[model samples]
Target: MTSAPLEPFAVTIDFATGALVPDPDVLDRRLADLDGYFVADIDDPGVGAYTVHEVRVPPTGNNLLSSTTVLAPGKVGDEYFFTKGHFHAIRDRAEIYLTLSGEGLLVMALEDGRTVTKEMRPGIANYVPGHWAHRSVNTGTTPLVFYAVYIGDAGYDYATIAERGFPVIVVEGEEGPEVRPNPRYVAS
Candidate 1:
């Protein structure tokens, strides 16, 4: 027997507050949760870091999944607060991030050592192509919020990134946010 077709539906999202009307499954990443992901150790482990609230559909075919990431503004040492970056498990899946509020940097890097950084602000949509591991960095004094859409089946490969760090890092500089080499990076 075959299963019934899924019905279409709409979910309301408040751009200003980054809230979904029906509520969403939330994954809160606290300072303690990101053990080795940062350059320095936090004095307190319970500090609020970032949150990802998403509405997920079935992980089949071309169905799309959407989520909002709110990264709290702070730092460990001089490095800014950032999401735990990941590449799609499928390796060829792409994603897009539309900045809703605050300021941030979309930092992406390839396995071959190529890296790119894009400024994210309200009204800007950054397209992340396939095979690049992408991380979001909040460079402002307020929360950095962005809406992201990706294929449902584009599973995340966070382990690879945890094992091999990104080639570049973002840090506070006298001029502004500066991009520098990640000395801890190991080749895959």
Candidate 2:
């Protein structure tokens, strides 16, 4: 009896041709940067309200390619605030949030400047559509923890985020107050 010849199962897409391929080693190394608990100061404007550590993922020497590990608004203690904004670049893929632990509030800003807020607890799955602007804040008494899983590169230029200025934030306060992006929070 004769056996049939083996066929190629490999397939490729033009869009993914020049994209930066994220490797496991690079991802693990980059993610290692954020290895501790972070705190945000609510009353101080000079100091950044959010604490962020980055996982550095170098580009694969490809054009139209970029990737990085960002630990933003992950764990919150008692109180926290996230400024409202949106990404100008329309992401072709959807973004997901994996709740590791804790609880917080999710805020979405509309094009017309209108904002919507939701109460979020642990085990809650959050999905943000491409190009959708959103933010999260911790309102619970305990620290809120979660993982942000962003898939598909959307240029990595968060255009929707405020460059510099006081952003809109809704919280349980005596008077409605505006919140600004923490100075320490750096996006790479």
Candidate 3:
């Protein structure tokens, strides 16, 4: 396999809303009908709520798989829209996320029961070590966007999160979005 160029790709697209992200192949994720354990009873938002655009690269040359995450602005009841948090299937593979635009928070849950959250804005980068399950929450009124890179073989274990929800949920607050303990969450 030919090695991919490390040089920057000229393709430009708005990361916040994925203005020009390739279509017919985008992988979308939605929280409208999740078990409703972390959110409230609500109408389905369908599958267009959020999307993952896989960046084209040499499939056999690089060990890293890159993607741009476009999270829509809205609410699942009082809770903000968020990524379905996951721990890498490889267990020892880490991931990195850099904010492109908009505002949000990256919430991370550890097996040790500790939860950490970081505010996101343009140019901010969050490094998630192995063994942590992380989710991204859109706290602002606009779309939340970011770039992420993780080991190609890492694989996401979303089922574990579905079984064991995050201990905290981001909700609208008087000043801004707040992170509060999830009433329905039971730590595993």
Candidate 4:
């Protein structure tokens, strides 16, 4: 018996030569439409100070451009799944977290499940591997805001992670809420 030929993964595209690259203009239009669709709470309960805005391109093949705006945790009382915990992924790449406002804890989960939580303030930045499971929490009375930029695919495979719910470790409790991956995170 013979097996069928495997399909090659078309992840990267050539732009200088005008290959099968994603259209930038098309992506800009989509991002503009998503200016303020969803928002998340940081840690404050008084107001919805901390929020995440999605600026992502399509998640089809690969080569993705995306960003998220994390507002300072405020008085918003909405239940955000990862408010007390963190999350991660399966692919390998580079990620940057740049603080935009206030202060908080930046939690990164190790391969063994143990987490390395860091104190972050405005103007501070941190970098980690793409596959590392991680999350941010507002530890201060003020909201902690930042931007997480991922330089990889925008497939959003983890968008359904919250819907499926995963067991998580968190501060202030032994058990935490089930978290789904962000929709803006394009899964490779």
lDDT of each: 0.89, 0.40, 0.78, 0.44
lDDT of 2: 0.40
- Single out the weakest 10-residue window by summed lDDT for candidate 4: 25-34
Looking at model 2, which ten-residue stretch has the lowest summed lDDT? 11-20
Model 3: clashing residue pairs? none
Between prediction 1 and prediction 4, the one with superior lDDT is 1
What stretches of model 3 exceed 4 Å from their correct place? 1-12, 19-24, 33-37, 56-62
Q: Is candidate 1 or candidate 2 better by TM-score?
A: 1
Candidate 1 is scored at a TM of 0.96
lDDT (10s digit) by residue, model 2, range 1-188: 24453343322211211112332222221112222212333332333333322223322222123222222332223224442334525444445554444556666544444445566565677776665556666555444444454543443434435442113443445452224333433333
- TM-score for all predictions? 0.96, 0.48, 0.84, 0.49
Off by over 4 Å in 1: none
Best lDDT among the predictions, by candidate number: 1
Give the local distance difference test score of model 1: 0.89
Predicted candidate 1 versus true structure: per-residue lDDT over 9-83, tens digit per residue: 877877866777787588989989878887787777799999888987997646898998899999999999899
RMSD of each: 1.4, 11.7, 3.2, 12.0
Q: Tens digits of per-residue lDDT for model 3 on 1-40?
A: 3545576653456765654445434776665545454568
Ordering by TM-score: 1, 3, 4, 2
Tens-digit lDDT string for candidate 4 (48-126): 3334444444432344444444434322233222332223333566567877666666666544444466666766888
Indicate whether candidate 1 or candidate 4 has the larger TM-score: 1
Q: Which ten residues in a row have the lowest lDDT in candidate 3?
A: 16-25
